[model samples]
Target: MSGELRVIATAGHVDHGKSSLIMRMTGMDPDRWAEEKRRGLTIDLGYAWCTLPSGREIGFVDVPGHERFVGNMLAGVGPVQLVLFVVAADEGWKPQSEEHLQILDVLGVAGGVVALTKRDLVDEETLAIATEEVLERIAGTVLAGAPVIPVSAGTGAGVDALVAALDTLLAAAPAPEPARTRLFVDRVFTIKGAGTVATGTLTGGCLSTSQTVEAYPTGRRTRVRGLQTHKHDEAKACPVTRLAANLIGAERDDLARGHVLAEPGSWRPTTVFDVTIRPVRDLERIPSRGAFKVYAGAAEVDAKIRLLDEPFARVRTAQPLVLDVFDRFVVRESGRQRTVGGGTVLDVGPPRAADPRHRSFLARRAAAARGDLPALLIEERGAVRADDVVLLTGGEPPTPHDGWCVAPTVRHAVRDAVHDLLGAFHRLEPLEEGAPLGVVRQAAGDAARRAGAPRAAGLPDTLLDLLASEGSIVRTSTTVRLATHRVALEERADDVRALLERISGEHEALPPTVKELLRAGTPRDVIDAASRAGTVVRLSPDLVVAPSLVDRAVALVHQHAADGITVSTLREALGTSRKFAVPLAEWLDAQGITRRRGDVRFPRED
Candidate 1:
């Protein structure tokens, strides 16, 4: 919910006073390893905490100075909130300093402070020249508009200003986010008093004394016996908090920095995953289409980086894929090197396809690495769902099948997909009125969930409206199917190919029973079909088709074609063999469809 945690790391060449500045600021030495002090260079990452004047707590990480520890430096740089690019006033910017800067830039460090150390060793003119050079070097970057402050841990000159600068920045800086929780084991050891304690940055989500955190890659779970941040007990520890969790029944030596700590069900293990990755600068040979180890959370695995677009890229990672894949989503393995770029998993198993739009997305992502979209990636991906952006950006979006970037969210596709099924049910004959929700879901595809059934949040309410508007479906409370797909059947009895028209025409003299009316003699199938067709009217069975041949024949007998007909003579026109003459008399009587008075038949008034 908050922005990001402020975890600053010190990166400077050997003898740049990186350690000394940290010690003076926090009144504590960052050289925790004895080997580091003896060698007069930072050997491993030493963590310290700083409380700014605004009362906000920030973590400071001091990485090693020797080139041998560059790997160690890489590990710490990613999780830190910002970089304090330390340069000695006497020595100015050095080689490793540039390397660190490049790494920071590549990792998208948006906020930094250039701490000009050893100020007492340089004169005013020299100091001015050094500051100008550093300024030029930092142009077109996040630190372009930043202030360059000169301070000596030895003299305390500008120390107050540095603290005040940090105080203001800390208050304004974004809070750290924990999408989920990841605790990478840095060092673990058994203690006489605490039993077993593991130390590392509590980088992801909250951890209290009672919560169980998993040792990842190894798949071990342990409870927090105690917690120490900057060597202080913690009820809840969050981003950049240097933590020593005393875990119950844990073997400290067995747990190391490369191993991870995570909350269960929050973190998972996979052998393959879709990721965005970048090569570290200064490596002479770019990786070919080859396999590399990937580490994420606490999981690690080897996977082939099937480079798309080109075998070699001047860009970092080339293409994104939708993959039904699994691997460590963090900690990419490039040949012999280890990179700390992995953080969260966007998807565990995904479909595969080729997508060129993936490249543009990657380009946009690389351009916006230090800006807003890192958070956007996490939000859209719903991967770690934690707060950190730096860790998960390691793997480009996945490129699965023929290598296309698959949209991470499946809800929209599934919603549209089920419309096909609903449409068919609406338009087709003899279906279940409405298609089964299961059929709708299956037709919707794998990525979608359903809504009405309350199981899958598949098909949202809005989409159902879309279907109705398009006439793709029809509804009346219980039924839902395609608008053009529904069918109405035979609604009339005895309606053969052309039987209905003749029956309607001939029966005009007197209404007939629905059964007898259609009789050029209709059958059950014909009647049922006609009934379904809605052609015949089923008047009561009483009034026969030949109402009274006697009355109508008598009436017709007196009439010639030129003369008007009378009802009594029409009945006489047909004798006992009335069947033949009956219909004819009826017809003549009904030139006006006939009229009747008591038992008499007459021609009706036209």
Candidate 2:
């Protein structure tokens, strides 16, 4: 494709020459770990970038096929857009290949170019049979319609065709969506002259130096020391380019395969997963509700399957759970001990506690799939990406046993969740107007689900409209406030009218910033709420002039300057802190009660 971003991986059982084939194809080494080259088989994930015949360079993540290192495989392939399923013609699809392929299918790795390595080891007929067997294994799967080619890593028989096919596949790859930011970390090493450097494909999202970001699971925050994309130093990196970010603060040991670099708060760690999972055909029987090992993203934990309607088991983690699946998840259990068949993630955090007696989750599960899982996860969690959804869901993305519309309902849930939050406010403190939109949105989502809204989208607008119309909503010139609650600095509706009387009379020339008044022991939220209630107007970011005080201040400034109120006059006039003095003058200028011309400030009528 003209502007495509390609991420491919190598898979097959160990000893199938996945590393050698890569070496032949790109002339780049994949065995960086000392033990890997010594063992003569890849025991970890290795990464490289190669240019296709078309001159389009793409990233290739080489993962281990050994059963012990499957977790490592999950991390490498988690972010890839394509796969290079390598099955030696002699060995065919072995345990490692099947497992890795199953993971690819579960992780939703689509568009693969199958390479039948070691073609020289077998007769033409044997090669055909092995190739046929490999095809049959992947048939009806994501790797089903993938292109297959034969090769000899030793003789380079079909290496040329493989590269050509890669070129064609990459040429047809779709352009990476710039809308959602994504980064896949593959290499973390200390530079000889520099410090810690992380190399990976910048799938989406932009990365630049001096930007603040956090490393997940570890909770270590750091700044980008420098950025390099496509082997060239850059001030910032755009999506779809291979990136090597030099990091500051984090020790080299603090980073690992499972560690994710993301925008702060964009991705969180999740325990419970509401997933749509499926049982492999080989399952001797369906698993009952109880503990089973769940593998996702880069982590795996023991979980209990809470099968729904008995259509599928509901998986419960040792802690809070978040992966969701219906009849469609690729779930495999070996006596409820380990997860062998992993499935794609549909929705990360739905209700695992959903009463299996009713068809509630079943009703909305299908919609979540067709609707878009990535969109759904971000909408509900306020997280920025599907990985965050993965973090929220507690696993890699869940593959739907059936289709779903997780996105639309999630958006609907946000509107309702924020609204009902207001209803709660109306009850707890009827005198209080409302809260901020961010807080409200989160509360509403939880409340809506609790109220049997089916999904977030089912929330009613009566709740949302009430918030907006009531002016209960506080807004920064930038952010929305459907959920962030506020209170006035001064008592409202005549609560302790004496305080306002004093502020109005004794301090006519100046006012207090909410922070300063808050020092007197009033809670910040309560102060903000009162301000929004119009008991007091925040004439400036810091300055708060009570409704009763504005008039006297106008009269006094006119008395003192008549011409204008300079900084010194205003400071001397208010006995308040500097925090309030500068802001009070600015507020006066805004009210059309005063205008600042050059160094002198004067009062002016609208």
Candidate 3:
């Protein structure tokens, strides 16, 4: 079986043999710059790869170790899972060694091997002492129990043992799982024939030639023209492997060191994140409320940390970082060059609150840390999109209906609001069918706000539709009401009903006007209540007729619909004058029951 690929990063003080050790192991110069070769130091990130005795391919990232280039060192070590920590045997332990170890610990690197280089310059006894010092230094770090191998790059002593140890270390490393692919671009340059080439340690998923990708935080889109892994052309590059992608449609100047290349829409940019932090044990005090630098996934950003209690804080970054939940980041004091703290991101794009000191805001932060989707739903108090929950928690998508996931508590709150609003409206206007749909939505929003619940904008339509579908409420094009709601008329309703019946029975085509009813001492409120209750149908401002009479007139129009019916024919059939016939005919036209052509009317096809 073919062996899987793994990436290992080199770290130590300047001129500590990191580059020379990689050159000896792989027989390839990791320092690509001519100036670096002349100065005998690694200036930037360098790459080389070799296949071990077991045929397992190991990629190396040679990083600069000078104090001024610590940022460059972080870029190399941020994404790799294994480290090859180099320390010159002549110099037992150095300042950069401690700094690099702290960084590895901050980044949470789980596996590593220590290389005691320059063994030729030291005796056997001295080499043993150097090895013991290195072991003591890494005793409490991520490399606590890692093996130490003494080797000399100039003489090739112990080189084979070092390679064999690396193979063993890699055999126990976990295989990468398929996920959203993210390539933190550590190098960007222009090739004569290939527009822009970007190289980095690819993680999360896979990349293939001809696939489209986006440079996040910049949102620049480019297509992959070709792919290379370990200097060999490949159709695809998998996670945890070194990759160089030739891109189309962009210039080299458009790309930068901190930018990330990812599949489109797979990642989102966030300026503020909620995180859980662990201050370095040696720090005198936590830099809780000041400017700091954050390093994560090859991106270094200036940020401000606001402590929200112990161990929990909010980081506001100057530049947007593409991150997911549980991603690790290191924080360093601005202008101090010292590691202060590091933590895992609990939430990207956390919810905003008007008052940070509010208990609800603190509760929301706690909920985000625990990744409790149900708690978020309860806090939202309404329907939330399943996609949003997945993004927030970095977990499986929640169960959804009609593209919305609603917690049972929130769903119950909406249902109760609807019920109470409809009950109050029914009590106030007993003769009416229900309240207007807009009124119910306004009430629901107000109740949510008063209860400190999450009020999603434009969610009432979904709730009402769901309720209506389940038979809890009655929904129409213009109104909503309880399923059991019915019109309840007052004591004076009988008198008004008697008047409407007499008028429609006497004159089937045109009944008494609203003005006539008010003039005859029938209360206007009573008339309006009757109209709203569907007992009386108002065709126009001056025309009020019984619903039964309107149905008869519609049937008459339908019978004559084959050709057309004239106003004179309608007037003669109903025994009404032109004064009443004109308005009734116009009302029918407005209702789409009939279409008028000249003085004749025909039933509307629609």
Candidate 4:
């Protein structure tokens, strides 16, 4: 059937007919392991698929119902949106059934159907009692108000009605958004011909043949050699479908269960995550600082928990996990058999707080739990991508510029700091044009820290350009200054101006060098001041000339353009020494006023 594909995970107690129901529905046995078939117990994840009458393809992730294989169950359920919760009618509700329900609630699974299996083994009155009990147990859970269907796989009774119910459920469930594709590998094996194969329920985005993917935690790169969905080869596979990918570039030993295959650079491995956890209400004790087993998206790792305010905890996994914001996880004590608690990941990689119990730290984390993405951006004081915002807030993509989004408040703060730094620089060194950009940035960081504003590592070029655009700051290739800033000569103003004027009047065609000015008893500071004020121009380390005299030299060269000019000829024409005329000739050539030909210079044609 060429219709929408959906993945549905089955959960219940051991020996509750989960596999039997899936086999009956899909006509393909889900149990793949020989040991599982011999023991008549599902020891690992199984897969099957069927096409509904309405043309919707449904994939089933059959999980082990025994208490010990809960980790496997979590792997299958973590990535699937729809669940088929099974409870045997003859047995009513069992201990594993309650634990699975708790795990589902903690994981925040929002949609599912509660199926009452083994109806043929119970009488009508007994079936009614079992249905009532099942309904009551799930009254406050994700399955509350969900339709409970009584079915018997042996007699094939109510199977059609179950399919009809699933059809309706699939119709109403929201489709997965096209994001970065992630496939949490629950099973890894090698075939006779194929090199390595990994299978999981794909989500977040789509996968295509020949695309490059990275195996997380190990970071080994691989390419997709082939793709299959629902046992049919496909060129591409989308989210909410069971996928098997033949991979190249890695051996079966290199990949294993709990490793994820994702689009290159789409996900990062993280050891620390900030989360808001809700302990199972019937839990005997609150989760505390201790070693625990964490199950998230087909990953099981040992982690330690440290509480952060109420409903929040910082979990540090023993190994890095490929996770994103808002991803759900289940936590069990190191030696406990039941789930202790679970929560949504608030920050995949959180910063280390100086004092985690500090009021400000707690407040910021609380805001993050409430989906305040802008607050997180401000705290980070950096640019983030639209995908990050979506993952964190569960909201639509925000409009971004240059693929990175920065808070306006952060931009304004940096601009203000730059302006303040420029002002201070002008006050400190008025004779200098401006401070170097690096110095200004350092001063801005100090200012932000002093003012209790979050300190960014460095100012972004985009923010700097934005500041320049606002007319508050002027940015050159190397320096930054206030727009209104100007170099003010504080000493020898009158003497420098007088000296420059006399030099220009006496030497109209040529200017004296700084050594000559110094030999004339003019102070070094006076000559420097004159140059800084633009009254005189420093053409080279040894030559300083008045702007008026340089113009006169240009005219003299133009007058001799027909014959061309040389340094010696210009020296004779200006009645100046060769030492003074050589630098002048080179300056004119550099300025495009004259073009050099061998040892001669010609007036520029243009």
Ranking by TM-score: 4, 3, 2, 1
- Model 2: residue 298 alpha-carbon error in angstroms: 3.3
Query: lDDT tens digits, residues 225-339, model 1?
Result: 8788766676777775667789997776557666777776444443434344444444443366554544332223455554445321211222221111112233345564544
* lDDT for position 160 in model 4: 87
Task: Please give the clash total of every predicted structure, in order.
Answer: 93, 86, 0, 0
Instruction: Score residue 186 of candidate 4 by CA lDDT.
Output: 90
Strongest candidate by TM-score: 4
Residue 321 lDDT, candidate 4, scale 0-100 = 87
Write down the lDDT of every candidate, Cα atoms only: 0.56, 0.62, 0.81, 0.80
Candidate 4 lDDT over 1-606, as tens digits, reads 279889999999999999999999999899998999999999999999999998999999999999999988998898877899999999989999999999999888858988899999999999999999999999988889889999999999988889888889899998775456789889988988788899987886888899999998898999999999977898998888899999988799878888888877667688988887888858755567667988888899999988876777888999888876667899998776678989878776565772543335445655564445545644454455566655444444446644446566566667778887788878887666678877776765555444434444443555566667778888887788898987776555777766776577767555556787788777776676567677787778867777876786788888888988899988887777877888889999888999999998999998
Q: Which regions of candidate 2 are displaced past 4 Å?
A: 1-4, 177-180, 184-187, 229-231, 240-242, 284-286, 289-292, 310-339, 356-365, 369-606
Better of 1 and 4 by lDDT: 4
What is the Cα-based lDDT of residue 356 in candidate 1? Answer: 54
Question: Distance from true position, residue 219, model 2, in Å?
Answer: 2.9
* RMSD in Å for model 2: 12.7
- Looking at model 4, residue 384 earns an lDDT score of 56
Model 3 C-alpha lDDT versus the unseen true structure: 0.81
> In model 1, which regions exceed 4 Å deviation?
1-6, 269-306, 309-354, 357-606
